[model samples]
Target: MTMRICALLATMMLLVGCATDDPDITVKHRVPHGSTVAVVMFQDCGIPNQADCAGSGAAAGSIFIRILSQKPGLHVASLPRPVAASAPLTDDAAVAYANKKGYRYVINGEVQDYYRTGHLALHSDRVAMSVRVLSVKDGQVLVTYTYQEDSKTHFASPDDMLEDMAKQLATSIVVEPKKQRQGDFMFYKGNGG
Candidate 1:
């Protein structure tokens, strides 16, 4: 009985370790409460060529606004493209623009890969993206998120893939407040949480 329990505990520990997320992609500083975040248009990689890169970039930008807006207490907005041709298209530029506009944080991403490989149920919709969360005040990057799904994991459309990515991106930006400890019990800090 003792040996069985010990083996079970060992297995559980191993599983817990495996379940941990990649530390390199974790959020550094949490975005402050009651602050506005702007999401800029994602840049498309145009892999193999420039086929659907433009479309995918627009789709990604819209998806970020839609999904993140649904999160409670998160203020999400779609940052418009620069009107002046002199303004460069880059993450640093986006951050600067967001800072000037008085936003608290900014999100910028790149749609690296968007294509299907194979056919029907056996097909793999290869999708890769990288998102960065920047501090509008100091231009510091708080989070750098990257995801790639190329395995035979979906029979869904590329739009579905973008939605999934947006959901993950939300997790990286908007973190839930930690539970307050009251002796052996834990509770929310307040109604705001």
Candidate 2:
């Protein structure tokens, strides 16, 4: 009985350790304050012959736009519906579109993989995507982020995973100072003039 109890405790400890591991991986680059950004629909790059990949990319793109719309500090520009689920806008095209639309930057990417398993109970869900941030002025690539999540033990639906991924992506780019700026002068009582 004691040995069984000890084994159970060890198993529980291992599970707890695994649960606490961070799943988010993000790489960030500098984006100027108050810059306007437009999010282009992501293209689907799922496995060939897979029917489910049909609209996954567009869905991911829409999710990111919705999440970013609520984020403060940066201006979000309206973008037309994706031309094709598997066709992403080229860098030059994205830059020209942003310029024409009065935006400083553009965000676009592809949904490389997405899948859900176990229909009745929803055993697991996985999503992978690649994101790019480009400048409209020079058509320069500023940052690229690759994100993937596989949730088996956490019990999250595919939609939930996508929403969380979008939120994470939006959080990385929407940086703002905590205090509101009042023109060039920023007065602080403690700092000596």
Candidate 3:
């Protein structure tokens, strides 16, 4: 009996030791403070019906921007609306617009497999969301993040569905801050002139 109890305690300690409070598991580009960012509404690459998620995508980007914006010197621009013209904001266009808006960096993504439910045949229902980001200037792929949540809801409303998706959207996108420019800062400083 004492041996069994000791084994159980050891197992519990091992589990506790493995636990972590670190929120961000993925590391992507990290932008520093005073850096401006413009986010384009993420496109839904999964299903046609889920394609036009500008409203929800914008909301999701807002959540992501909110967290990144919290960095002491960062300033984020409102996400750009999807343009119906020509090619839906070409990479060059996105960069130009962001620069025009005085943003030093920008965030744009593609979202897919996004869905929500109030109830499942089982006791718990699940929400799923996925997205990928691309860096326009260097054509560097940033990160792809996916999230799902399961919970019990007595009744699901449109708001409830949206809220769950937004929650997952916010938590899963754990982008690291871009590295600060290392060598001598060679750029001219704006003096409100």
Candidate 4:
């Protein structure tokens, strides 16, 4: 019996090794380098007046921001939690807050949806996130990116799924920089170092 079990395990390992890797898999998007980013917790975008899943959504956004800060080549700034609150929560108050923090780019976000539904005979959890970026200098929107994911897990643990979502968000923000032409005077200082 032990011999038979070993044979079965070996076969399974071989089959797994034979599986093809995905060629189209990519995470990072194209973004300029050295841009100062201000990450804020996404506000609740769900129906108002009722206590929905706002806290969880906000928590997820916070985690996503933390993960994004750890990525390479991104100049992320730290703003206070209250200062990073929702648009309606802070209103025009965010301008002063950003100026005080010396951040050029402000990221405002909203968690539109998050839910876990059971399939006919199986169970799964779905997580969705949406975020908007605004240029505080001119009040122009930079971009808005939304991410969603669904996965199945055993009853004992769902941490893996959450980690996967965080990873996806982190990958999405890792982007390449754009090039710009500079005038001679821009670099021609008296003391060129």
Best by TM-score: 2
Provide the lDDT at 44 for model 1: 64
lDDT of 4 at 29: 29
| Candidate 4 segments exceeding 4 Å error | 1-31, 44-54, 81-96, 116-123, 152-193
* Predicted candidate 4 versus true structure: per-residue lDDT over 1-193, tens digit per residue: 6999999998886666444332222322233565677765556546455344556546665676666677776667656556333345342345455656787766655555555454443654555555545566765555555655445332212234445555654555545533333434555578667
Candidates' TM-scores? Answer: 0.71, 0.73, 0.48, 0.54
Ranking by TM-score: 2, 1, 4, 3
The residue-by-residue lDDT of candidate 1 on 62-118, one tens digit each, is 987899887766889888766332223677788888878888799877777777544
Report every candidate's CA lDDT.
Answer: 0.71, 0.72, 0.50, 0.54
lDDT of 1: 0.71
By summed lDDT, the worst window of 10 consecutive residues in model 3 runs over 18-27
Clashes of 2: 0
RMSD values, in order shown: 9.3, 5.1, 11.1, 9.5
Could you tell which candidate, 1 or 2, scores higher by TM-score? Answer: 2
Checking candidate 2 for backbone clashes, the offending pairs are none
> Best candidate per lDDT, number?
2
What lDDT score is found at residue 15 in candidate 2?
A: 77
